[model samples]
Target: MFGEYSFNNSQPASAGGHPGPGAGPAPGNLPPQSPGFVGRERELAHLGHLLPDRRLITLTGVGGVGKTRLALRAAAASGPERPDGVWWVELSPLRDPGLLTATVAHTVGLADHSARSLDEELCAWMADKKLLLVLDTCEHLIAACRHLVGELLQSAPDLTVLTTSREPLGSPGEQLVEVRPLPFEGPDSDALALFRRRAVAASPPAAAAFDDPGRATIAAEVCRRLDGIPLALELAGARLRSWTLEQMAQRLGARFDVLADSDDALLPRHRTMRTAIGWSHELCEPVERLLWARLSVFTGDFDVAAARAVCAGGPLPASRVERVLAGLVAKSVVRRTEERGAGIRYRMLDTIREYGHDWLTELGEVRTVADRHAHWYLALAQAADRGWMGPGQVDWYRRMTAEHPQLRTALEQLLKCEPAAAQEMAGALWFFWFACGHVHEGRGFLERSLRSGPRTGTGYTQALWALGLTALLQGDMDAARGLGEECTRSADRLADPERELRAAYLHAVAVMMPGDSVRALTLAGPRARAGHGGRSSGPGWLLCRLATGFALCDLERFEEAAEEARGLREACAELGERWLRAYADYILAMSALGLGHHGEAARHVRAMLSNKRLLGDRFGIALGLDLLAAAVAGLGDGELAARLLGTGHAWWRTVGRPQMGGSPALTALRDEGERRARAAIGDAAYETAFLGGTAAATG
Candidate 1:
């Protein structure tokens, strides 16, 4: 039942520096742009006309004025029109001016920047390439960006640069596209169009309401208040899911007065967005601002409990979190999002959230804020870990996986400030290593977190166990054995049953790294059946059994492996383990594939993928994709095989797993499997279908 997992590490050409005109966008390239490109047909055509001659074209607009989305849409639509490729460069996290050029170069896969000035090398490289470079969100680094774009234009006349900012570059040969707010006329206007789109997203039936006088008026008002900016309108409309029209009007009135700053010097409506957001924030109570500051800790949408844990304190009671959240939503300070089967959640726009973060920091509460951020994430990691190991493991992972970006951001900030806390964070995320198929990420963080602090307490014990499990997953026998032994010794001294259970599971799994299927089965079999109480039986012990069973199947011990999987399933079901069932199904799928039961294998693989996908488990979903691809290939369905493989490749890229680094044995097995499939289908046909399928998948 041991199906191997892999990820795609291919970055975009602009990011990974892969040289080939026909070479596709780098892996994990830009996510699919929203199909919400409205009223930009004229702008897009204008930009296209200028693209042939001008090497640098920039779209300048106020924040929330749809710069990034427009640029992204233009790039994707124009990618095929360009010869080299369309490369989008998002330059927001780059702070140091000196590292600006290096950041660009590193993204394009340039190694050893110390050997040459990155600017010079970048210019030289672009001179020969006919690609379109879309530099997004550049307002924060305007001067450095202006200089770089100017030099690149001078040197690489054939290359095209598309930039988005709050202001123009004001450079020679620059075709400045001054993006204005959508025109808020009747329903047909751009502003109204954007509002209708957002309203439709909130309530699909609202699409028909566009023709209604009252709804259209409100939509127009919303568009006008938001200054026809798509992001702000979307934020406004999202609140409509719960808010009434009258409430919206009242809030907008307060927002406009505050945002407009009636007595201040007159400014462009777009610039007033910041003021509008400030007004919205001011409408929030001290607790709302506090919650806003804490929400800034997340890089993506977050849950209510997370907000409560991180943002609550100082005059604010955690029990009143729901009310504060309601206030923020009422004022449109926090945007709510829905998760299937999970309740509604909230987030702040990057720009607005950053403003609140700045305010929080200025209040001399950064350390306190940082502490809350760490503490909340520690709780998050623990919950995710527990979810992964419990029933509905797949579903739990899906819910937890949705929070991956936010969790990572929290942990990163924590590691930066209190490196010692990283130990707990890493340990807490240990189940993620095997369950989500994120062995590499799990290993990297575990190693870094452990090295950051001395080996002691639960944190140290957890780290040791995590390290061993990661090694075992990657088939690093020696490292796994050593770490496993170390983990067991540490746990023994600690005398913690939970820790001991985890360490023993790792030890059992490590036995398989040395190709000892019998020993691994002997060591992990009984433990695999042992109940983990609230923890899903799918963590170390179950994963070890699955892997060992796969090894046993390869060694011709099919009956033993199958029996073990069946036995484990029964135990898991008795414990109400829904998540463990998915893993068991995956193991059975692998065994069926090995046994040449193609149809059965495909069914099991599909089940596993569906289960994991529902739970937001990207890692497991990727593995399921890989298994499905192989299963289809084994079934002689070349077309289906190619499609599954392409999807698997995309998911792998998103996960950022590298080949030939860990688990050489599993990697080789996959390579051999791919080779065998290719030999069966013929190389030419497989390549054609694979490439075509990959192209379709990316689109």
Candidate 2:
């Protein structure tokens, strides 16, 4: 309210008896202030002509390039031409991806009773209507914009979508009109005219005030530096009231560095790019502010439940995080995106979020808030792990995976600690290492957790198992053996069978010395059975079994190993999750290859590769690449196999997974593949050592 501008907050005039907000013929009153649209003549005409042919017109341009102003002009010009109304859908305040369609629906005043699809209701409302839909700031919601525009085009051909974005909306019938900067040449260039107009508006006697031709030249330079982008030019002009043109130019870089400047008294967002965001922040209610600040903790988009858990500190009730989220949407500070889902995910623009981050830092809440955010997300990851290993596993995994960016942010926050947030934050997400294919992150987190202090009970077991698995997966026999021993010994003292079983399987996986496979299998078998029987469906169950089977394959028990892997695959499918299924597939593929089932091995390996890629598993990529190379080699395409092997080895070394330590099966296959590929592509010893040796430990 403090930053509120002097605009009529009431109804506006129209040809259809629509009451004007003030004593003016224009819809919002204060006259059209037409300025005859300085230089958008061609763009306007192009949009005008296209309006008759296409329903969706997306105007794309760089920030400050007058996209919003041009869109407003278009909406104003096309208003009377529309039958139902020319409605502007301001998406700046929307942050929840899940509520994107709902935001549109609410803006258009369309009601969907019976809980029917909002799209269906909105489309139905528009079907028989002729309206101009001006959707502003749609870059963050491009997918949802495309979907909505497409639906509206199909259902209501007469309903038009005039959108402003940083990029094209990529819809079937979207007519992309790229808005370039206003011209900088000639007295009548849109750039010069915009600069002058904005200068006059800010300083009424600016012409008389700056009698020197140098002031005018400097003004032009300011406009030119900003590329004649209207918003930027206007913002630059506003500085004329306080600072000399030279001072403004001298301090320009600060726009990016020092988010807000107290000297500027413009709109909140106009104070600086940072303060414009702060202005938007100021518009939010207290609860929304909390959500916004906490949301700033995320590196990228996040789901609603993540918001509820992390941002909704005790002050803001859980029941109202969604409603508070809605308020942020209206202010255009947070945008709702549909790339995620109706689960109501939200994100801030990068520049805007940086401002929020600065504010969060200023509040001195960065550490505590970050810890809470990390803890909540860790709990979320663990919860997803439970769902991933249980009934309806695929759906649960999807929910978790969809919110991964938030989870990643949480992990990063946990890397730095506040004691209040560290323990739960570190322990809760152990399963995510395997669940999401973030083996490196998992390993790093577990090692960090273990090093921090002595954690006990379930949390300690989780960290130990996670640390051991990470080492095992990286082919770090030494670390795996040591950690596995510590874990099993600790579990023995704690009398937790699950923990002991996990430790035994991990130790077997470590396989420090020769003939360790038999011992590993012996240790892993009974616990794997007990794990398979229990409600605990995490890595301990099938991951251990897979490790044991790999050990069996190492021991030359091909038939039994293949059978064991087959059972793991079935168990994984029953779990119905992505990353785990992928792991199971990798194990079976290895087993098949050991049994000389080349074709089956190829199929399984390909499946695993696809799944790992989908899961964004950087660590898994190394193993998948190696397996894929083996399958290609089996196909008798030695040249192709060599090429793949080179790529695989290079990638494996880059990820710093330990050399298979001394496993004859894994090492021999890798060496053979590398030797074959090197014969074709010359020796590059550096490639072998690219990321080898203690990379995981260092990380």
Model 1, residue 176: what's the lDDT?
88
- Candidate maximizing lDDT: 1
Q: Rate the local accuracy (lDDT) of all candidates.
A: 0.65, 0.60
lDDT of 1 by residue, 1-699 (tens): 212222223222221222211133432134356666788878888876777777788898777888887788777766666655666666654444555665454343332111234567668766766668878778778899989988887888677888998788777878888887777876689877777777677767666657777767876776776777776776666556666655776788776776455666546664567666665566566877877776676666778877777777878888998898887776557767665544577877668878788887877787787778777778777776666555556455555555655656666776777777788888887766655544555676788888887777878888888887676555466788888788878877887656666676677667765557666655555544364322334355555556566566656665666676776667666766655566677777777877788799888877776555444445466567767777777777765576556556555443344222334444554564466558767888777766655554343
Task: Give the TM-score (vs. native) of candidate 2.
Answer: 0.55
Q: Could you estimate the TM-score for every candidate?
A: 0.65, 0.55
